[model samples]
Target chain A: MSELLNTLMQDARVWQGHRHNKTTTPSESTGYQLLDNQLGGIGWPRGALSECLVDQPGIGEIHLLLPLMQRLTGTGKTVFWLNPPHTPYAPALAREGINLDQVVMIQTGDGGDFLWTLENCLRSPVTGLVMAWPGKLATRDIRRLQLASESGSNVCVLFRERRYTDQNSPAALRLELTPGDHQDLKINVIKRRGSWPGQRCSLAMAHRADLAFRETPQVVQGPWHQSRR
Target chain B: MLWLYLHFPHLLLDHIRRDRQDQRPLVIVEGTGQHVLQACPEARNRGVQTGMRLKTAVTLAPELGIVRAQPEQDARILEDQARWLYRYAAHITLVSPDGLLAEIGSLQKLYGGLPAVWQTVEQALDEHRLTAWAATGHTPLAARLIARAGKGECTGDRGHILRTLETMSLATAEFDAKTCTRLQRLGLNTLGEVFALPAPELARRLSPEILAHIQKIRGTRPDPQAPWQPPHSFRQQADFVQEIEHSQGLLFPLQRMLSELEDDLCWRQQDTDSLHLILQHRHEEDTRLRIRTSGPEHRADGFLNLIRLRLEQQPLRAPVVALVLSVKRFIGREAPAGQDLLGKSQDLNEAWHTLISRLQARLGDHALKRLSPQEDHRPERAWSASEVQSKHKPRLTNPEHLPRRPLWLLQGPQPLTEPPTAWFSGPERISGGWWDGERVHRDYYIAQLRSGQLAWVFRDVREGWFIHGWFG
Candidate 1:
């Protein structure tokens, strides 16, 4: 009877009410305590697909992943960036404590390579994290990536436009991000496994104020300035 | 010392018949194309004997296929066979046209005994579908002569071999016709009868060349053989009787060749990164395809897959009659670095190499790149995208307390059209690149745009404002 119960529990369709509060999915910390609390203290889901919907390009999107990147790279695991919108600044990444030697960037010419590279990177055991910005992916494509991530036992994060929010995804965790007031970020947990969805959370992104010059530059009138006017 | 000799009666005939499925009669004619030098079993069954004139052979077996033998090509085939035999014996001498002489006296203990060594060669020949007459003798010439005479037996006993040689007729003694007639006239009907004659009298009667031949066969004079060494590069080709119209048809022959290469590489304990394939057409120029791997690889499956992808991408322009595969560069293989005492990392490096090569085979080599930071103040000059490296190197320590930079820098700075709605911080001056003509004197700022998108914008001293990068 116990062996039969174990086999039944292994099935995906089987759901037990008492097991709801216990999170069994392998997870890693997002490095942000507030976001960790927002995720029910389980942090980011590992060995699975997590989708992020962004409102704009900037607004601390990459900052949210800095802690995880540092942790993964520090352990000598490779991180692949596939078809990002812009060039990943090496100096910035290096400064953020990411090992430059462990980072690989792949640029694909067409949509087919974009999907192929994402899948290959996620399926490789050597890679610790696969971050991709696929322009448009089919439902089956997303499902394939989910399966590959589970098999490879790596973290895969797909960043798409907020326009894809309405389309259903097979990701284990889904979140939507928008710019918040006071240079902060607003995160809404759209979906997660074995947890209540629609959990809204906000995190402060004001640490970037140190990057700007605190004192203003004083400009004196010069002969070249007069000639240009 | 014990020596082994292998004589291939129909090397070229077997090579050609193995490529095709047809069981029709086939024969290899001499270079002059008049007399048949060798015949297959099918032709032999039809009573087309060796040394028969081409016309009569054709009359006997009308469906017989004849191929004119080229001495140079036959010698090359012999060398290929020697390469395969090198796996079993280290010291091998190539007796050209269709024979291999291997020094096996030193290798008897390594193989346990003479019969075991003989069995190993016989098994290899059977697996390759080859027919060879093998014999062992006390001398190289004796082994060659015994094998050529079709009285080969696996024995190392000097007395037994001598007894067998004694009963042999004078005709098969490999003597010139003149010496054979002379010996017969002297009432010497067999080699034993000839050996019974006094040595001084025989030496005085026979010419020095004939006398030396006898002494060499009798193991009185030392006959040294030049050892054949494997070539530095590997090259093998296959010719097809039927024209292969499709590129997919070439894979069957290529698979066999690649496996041979795998064995060759394994024997050498080396790996290769490149393979050159040439497809010969009837009327068109040859199509050459070069397949490369990211690192040293020896597995035939990996190479076959890469070649398949290459053929799929660019197909044959015309029907091909022959295909050649060559690998010139070989890398020394290093011990595998996997599975430490903890056994946590189980051949991950090998899997990584496979993934890189597979991705590069479908995508171009330049599609994948590694990013390493350089020591330049300029953002564009500070980073470089290079080909993936096989070895990992220590990383340079990044400078502490650096100003925050954007995660994504545009390929080139774009012009900013509108002013910012609010300025969080501004007027930080960055002026550099004076040594180079492309100087930059600008004041950068962190500003919030009207669309609520934070931008890293800078105003040039002589030019308008421009946006450089995004935080994402």
Candidate 2:
């Protein structure tokens, strides 16, 4: 009777997935409370590709990631930036307490090199985070990056245009980043594993401070930015 | 010190004939394409002389194969031989275009005696099917002169060595024709007879250079030699007897070279980042490609995979006669602590290095760039692209302790005619560049812009507000 009860106990734990629908895999904090709450593991899925879609490029996208970037880079792990839209400002990264020397930038002139550099960075043990702005990768390539991430045990985050939301993706988690009211950063959870989606979060940056250096109102927006409200 | 000199009488013939299996009469001709520089035994037996014109050599031996002599090939082959001989002795020097000199004084204790070391060297030469005339002497010059005369005697006693050297013809002593004629006029027919004359009298007759040579031979003057160091650069080549048009045929020879390279790297405890492969084509320019790695690496399998991938990506344009693999950059290989107690990084670094190398090999150069800090106050000029490396121990210091700065700096500061919504801090004045001529005077501020981006904005005080960077 005791032996039969032991088998019943093992089976009982297996059914717990139905009630919680979750796992206890080791996690890294996303630094945003709302988004973390919505995630099954309560953080950005570690060792998986997180597809981040931005409706408009450079719309406080880096602001949303600074807290987590700060946490990872604080431990002296290298962060790889593959073909970023613009050169990463040293002062900005240094302010976040990231060791600037640890950051690596790979310039991919062609598509083959783009995928190869991304997969290589993802599979490296020293690479703590790999952020790439890729030009339309095929589904097979995305799957390859996913497999590479599992071995690398790193958070591979890909930034793409919001229009790609309709395209099929194999990323473990996907979100769209946009500007919210009051200059807040808005993030909409489009897809996530083992969880219901369509969750939204808005976080404020350090409040905008103005210096009385200019008198005209003809300031142009950056290329990553399309229009101002 | 006891020295061993190895003279390669027909090294040029031996080098080219290493590919031939049969006893075909062969000769290496001079650059002028007129006279024969060296000949094999078969050609020599057929009355083909070293100084004979090509026409006479052809007339003497109709079946003789002739290959033009290249000094570069000679030096390369000589150094290659030195690298092999270095295994037997620590001190080995390349006697350019012809031979090698090895100091076997210390090796006597290791090999037990002179005969054993001689046997070992002979066995190695025989294994490689090379012909060498070796002679031992008290000095390198003595050994070289004795070996060149083909009157080699294996002995350590000074008397026996000089006795054998004394009988060699004055002409065979390698003195110039004028020097020999002068020596003959003095009625000095033998080296022993010349040695019998007083040193001061001989010094008056011969050139200062010849005086030094004789002193070095008699062990009365210092004859220092620079020991040959195996070059950090690695180069190994193979000639495909048959022209190979297919890429797969290249892999076999490449694999052999890589295995030898791995053994070499293992011996040196170093790694290389780039491999240059040159495919020699007959009657065409050699096709050369530089195979770069994503990082420094020294593994045969990883390099072979990269080679295979590259070959597949870029097919051969023409049939290749030979393939040469070389590497000029090397870094020390740090020993890894294998199988840690946590089992977290069991050869993980090695695995990643192999992965990066393979990626670099496949995608080619410009596929990998690492960022390192540059010593510049200007944020735009504060960083440079560095190659990824294994000794990544946080090499760059941040500008954190200085005035508050942003995490992400723009490629170039964007012009903003309008002011920030609010200014939090900084009236920090930065002025410079009068010396280098790109003068700039700016009042920087930490401000929150209209778009809610906390930016590092600066006013030229004359040009207006510009959003220079962002604090994440």
Candidate 3:
């Protein structure tokens, strides 16, 4: 009975749903209340690699990470994107509150140079975050970048095609993004350091259209029919 | 009137062998002829001597490297040495072939004494491993003669200088052969023994040139020397004994040159923004790599790291025979970062600048950029990649309540086949580029498409609706 009282007192913090105080890393807030609550530190861990696996290229993948990127760049830290799949539309990035000046996009034709550049940017002391969408990579390549990002005040986010979801990753967080019901961005938390990883979050991405323009005009739809004829 | 002379008797050989990791048997010989001008200790151990025939030297040491001394290259290197010595003394003169002379009388108060200045220069030479013989004299001519004769010693008093000069033989004096033979016929052996004669008698025996030399050594004649001013830019090159096929092998020579450059920059308290490295190839045109830092940089290691990265990316196209490192864009450092009041610590801003510059070095100059908003309303022209540093927090006021825009603009607009199922916002009209050839007139809207994706679509006034971007 005395042992049970001591154990209960020691495990009181766990009873309150805050068991990870000692194991959780210090982090920057994720800016989303529900997601933050589910995370161990209530935010994204700093100085660790995170992976974002997506089903398609343009389903608001860049948007999911924009808030964190904006926070870092706003503090005069640079964010480097290595061999991005699409042209980094500067105007769109600026609209997301990212300082257009702080986004450094690196283009490399060779795979080796791409990895070397990613590692260098990750190890930089002034780097806020490093984002690379190198289509597919061996687990060791991601581990090398993870090691480089560990010693600095940086976060490395890797975006990969969704087919790579089965391979194990060394990233601190692995989020799988896909289009959900009603066009919401569905985020499946595949891996979260120091916490349980099976939770899904959906964020409403865009303003709903008004009733006036909801219907497709008969004349505007004629181009496809005309081409078919 | 104190003067210091630095004589580089083995300047060519030293330049050849200084940065080499292997201390092999090597010597510099006359370009046109086969006579050895200088030999390293390894060559000397093998019975190689100065003025020995190159063929005989080769027989003595089978692996001996015979480097032909190029006069023009030697003179330029001599001037380059003078450029660094200028950092120590304001008045510097080039003693051609392989020596430098600088007036150090005025520098005594600044450097504390002659010994301090001597130690400083000696430390620099030892650091670079350049072979030099230094001497101090009341006149430049006396110092040059003593240094050439290898009897370099600092004499504080005039009596001591005179006594030292008296010991210098007439054979070591720089007089012409005709005057030296005539002087020997007169039984004159040392400078003191020859100049002790009456002026009229000495004039009768020796030519006017020899008389002028004696007077100059004795500090009686007016000896004018043209002070050499350093060039506006710095360029230092080193040739390898063997052609270097690997870029990593060039770092040693580059190290010595860059640190010397760092010392030069420290003396002037300025910094350079870029380095122009030219690799001299054996069979191709010279390969040039221009390394630009994000801001002014003065550290040798900082410059070297960048070069290593670039060299790793682009290997030598052909075997490189030599390398020339030059820097012309000097940025005068402003009020340097200060230590805190309590004790010296690395300043944050300074550290960031170093980090940024180092990043710029490894990555090309274009790798790092800060954005500044442009006034143009065109979506493509709304921002510019400003190469300048954003050292401080941005002051750009991004006001709230502006019309929302997409975060991903397509490389080019994709035509929208059908109208959106739902329209959330905007009939925002955008019309411009009437002056330019590609005029655009459209009313843009943020609309939810049938695919449930919010797309940035615009209707051209004349044409149809097109999807411009994606709102994430």
Top model number, DockQ: 1
What candidate 1 gets wrong by more than 4 Å, as runs, is A1-21, A208-229, B16-68, B166-206, B245-247, B276-290, B327-332, B336-338, B399-403, B424-443
**CAPRI level of candidate 3:** acceptable
**Residue-wise C-alpha lDDT for candidate 2, range B92-193, written one tens digit per residue:** 888887989999988998999989999999998985578999999898888999999888878899988888777777787777899889999999888777
TM-score of each: 0.85, 0.65, 0.87
CA shift of B374, model 1, Å = 1.1
Question: Best by lDDT, which number?
Answer: 1
Q: Give the interface RMSD of each candidate.
A: 4.9, 6.8, 5.2
By summed lDDT, the worst window of 10 consecutive residues in model 2 chain B runs over B389-398
- How many clashes does the backbone of model 3 have? 6
Which regions in candidate 3 have their CA more than 4 angstroms from the true location?
A: A1-23, A57-60, A92-96, A180-183, A207-229, B108-121, B185-190, B204-209, B336-363, B367-372, B386-402, B417-419, B461-465
Error of 1 at B195 (Å): 4.9
lDDT (Cα, tens digit) per residue for candidate 1, span B1-472: 8889999999988777766656899888998999999999999999999999999999999888888888887887888888889889988999887999999998899999999999999999986778999999999988988999999999999888888888888889888898999999988988888767767788889877777777777888888888889888898877775678887888888888899899899988999998999999999999988888878899999999988887876778999987889999999998757669865564677777777887777777887888877766666677888887574777666446556677788889888777666565566678778888768787877776676567787778856778888765
Kindly indicate the candidate among 1 and 2 with the higher TM-score. 1
Query: Candidate 1 vs candidate 2: which has greater lDDT?
Result: 1
Model 3 lDDT per residue over B114-190, tens place: 88888988987886678999988888898898888888876557778888889888878887788888888888889
lDDT tens digits by residue: candidate 3, A124-207? 666787788887699998888778878776777888878888888888888888875455678888998766788888875433
In model 1 chain B, the worst 10-residue window by lDDT is B395-404
In order, candidate lDDTs are 0.83, 0.76, 0.76
Instruction: Please identify model 2 stretches exceeding 4 Å from their true place.
Output: A1-20, A24-26, A207-229, B1-10, B13-66, B90-108, B112-408, B413-472
